[model samples]
Target: MRENDGKSIIIRRSRGWIPINWRDLYEYRELLYFLTWRDLKVKYKQTLLGAAWAVLQPLFMMFMFTIFFGRMAKVPSDGVPYPIFSYSGLILWTYFAGALSMSSNSLVGGSHLISKIYFPRLLMPTASTLAGLVDYLIALGVMVFLMIWYHFPPSPGLLVLPLVVFCGFLAATGVGLWLSAMNVEYRDIRFVIPFLIQLWLFATPVIYPVTMLPEKYRWLLALNPMSGVIEAHRACILGHKPIDWISLEISFAIILLIFITGLYYFKRMEKTFADVI
Candidate 1:
């Protein structure tokens, strides 16, 4: 606790809202990598299919959608093959859903770590979210295969894929932080997550094209952050022309708002996690 020349070894705590310290996170960056790797290992460890499960989930979902939505419901696919069209959205959606599921439970799931050590709790959800990238890549490979099978050539629009993926990550991580923080006190939150995901799935444009929606009601779809991500994915991956910037802008604005508010909520509640969780 000794201080000399206006320097202190320990930064004193304050009652005021704690904003994220990028320096602290950077200093502990190695830990973030470690946690992320740990998640990857634990996820696939002792599994029959191992990492293939990543590809399978989305691949199988794409199959079902190709049958049900493409054939039975006659959903429009923006001129791309229904399988590839749905696969594009499924890949991104699966990653978002998986990350959200894992991250929303990460804090309580790792109760032992929180009780035993001192580190940024924020890193837990972040690690859980990022760990799903492995799954995303595996599923993306499936999408590539589908594209090749369907003779869908690659497009220059693929350049924006990274931005679309970033939006998905932001949206997932933001919601994950909020849920994980709340799950500490409300165990029932875990029960509701599945239903919430199902509802969110229908709300996003994964199974259908955004053009199917009337112009006036497009605003409602834009409110979902993944709407833009999924829409951009379909356009870029399927070589569809002209992304909907309006949707992307709306999604981006919402994600920023969610991320900032979620971070604040997580920080304000994190101090109590160790005790309650």
Candidate 2:
């Protein structure tokens, strides 16, 4: 027993938390990879179409918007082809929506692991968000094909695409962290998430061009972080003129603020997870 106790102490101290021990997170990278892979597998497992569902969703949405908005409502598409324009935004929006949904429910979804394991709780939601990126990449392939079909060449500004995508991830993860933490405490948050995402979809520029908004309202619209990301994506992909830099900067700041606050709140609530959950 004495020898066993000494060995256990050595093991515990060797793996003990260091201040800002994000290195441990890196050390646990394999676990994170497996968790992310598990989510991807579970997402498509036993489904008939499998990963093709990613391409189908935005494609179907584009068809509906083309008929309803472009044909009947006569909504503008910033002088770009309607189908390509909407599909670009929809692809990104779909990833955002999917990440938000998965991350928000990650804690509850992994309740069994939380009850049994001692890994970083943050990994659950982060892995859930990361898993959706695979679908985003698959959907992006269709977006590229649509661009070619519409005779739109990729813009030089497309080089900035990665930064724009990071912003989208930040915005989604920021809100998702808050939702996931709150959800662990209040079951109502789970019900509200779908409704919130639905409302957020229309609020975003997925179906309509931001240019259609009055100039005065454009500033207010930029308060939503997705506004900057969507507009940046259009500017990059469709060779649109430069976006309003001020609005993009403001949106970036807001997203950062939300991310910081959400992380803080999540940490505060994390202590109670094993207890309450």
Candidate 3:
């Protein structure tokens, strides 16, 4: 073997705990790209409908919410057209749900690769989360078309949409990292994740406006980071008003907390992945 190969093999077999070499991840960026592309292609390959599933999901949900919540329950939509208001929230929420679901199972799904390979285990979940962005963009195109059809012009605040989306990603990734790592040891988290996400969706302001909550409870509601994100999406698209800075700040803080905590937990469990998985 070459000298560098010998050195790498020695390092891999060394005794004490090793710090996660993040620079190695950057060096392997090409692998990350390939993994992400593979997931994207596999998601649509051999499917009759292909990308249509993306547009269909949020569109169908928006219709149901408009029918039941807008018409039946008489839920307020902050004075914007109910379909547009709900569709915007659904677009963001769907991305979060899809990413969370895929990522939580990513390590288990890639067990073959993990057991046989030396790449960063974190890449598995990261690729899954990144792949969900394709669906988000496809679904977002439908939302844009709906906006034009409804005669709603895009607002200047829409410039911040990317930041809002990033926050959603961070939140998803944070929770996903923890779940993916733990799932390697205990498979029960897999079954529990769906139920948790369902509860999370209702807790969020997806079907109804945040204004429907009593003023006294608004601060309490902001404890769920998604509440702030959904409200920001609506405010940006509908121009109903500026974002609630206080809520946004609280949500941002929580995202950071989850991110740091998740990273630590993921790294802590990473070494045992090959053994458990």
- Screening candidate 1 with a backbone cut-off below 3 angstroms (N, C-alpha, C), the clashing residue pairs are none
Show model 3 residue runs off by greater than 4 Å.
Answer: 1-18
Report the error of model 1 at residue 71, Å: 1.0
Alpha-carbon error at 175 in model 2, in Å?
Answer: 1.0
- Worst window of 10 by summed lDDT in candidate 2: 9-18
lDDT of 2 by residue, 109-212 (tens): 78888888888777888888889889999998887888788888888888888888888888888888999999999989999999999998998888898889
User: 43-149, model 3: which lDDT tens digit per residue?
Assistant: 88898999899889999999999999999999998888899989999998999999999999999999998899899887888888888888999998887898898
lDDT per prediction?
Answer: 0.89, 0.84, 0.87
Candidate order (lDDT): 1, 3, 2
User: Which stretches of candidate 1 lie above 4 Å from their native place?
Assistant: 1-13
- lDDT over C-alpha atoms for residue 198 of model 2: 95
TM-score of 1: 0.95
For candidate 1, the per-residue lDDT at 210 reads: 83
TM-score of 3: 0.93
The per-residue C-alpha lDDT of model 1 at residue 111 equals: 96
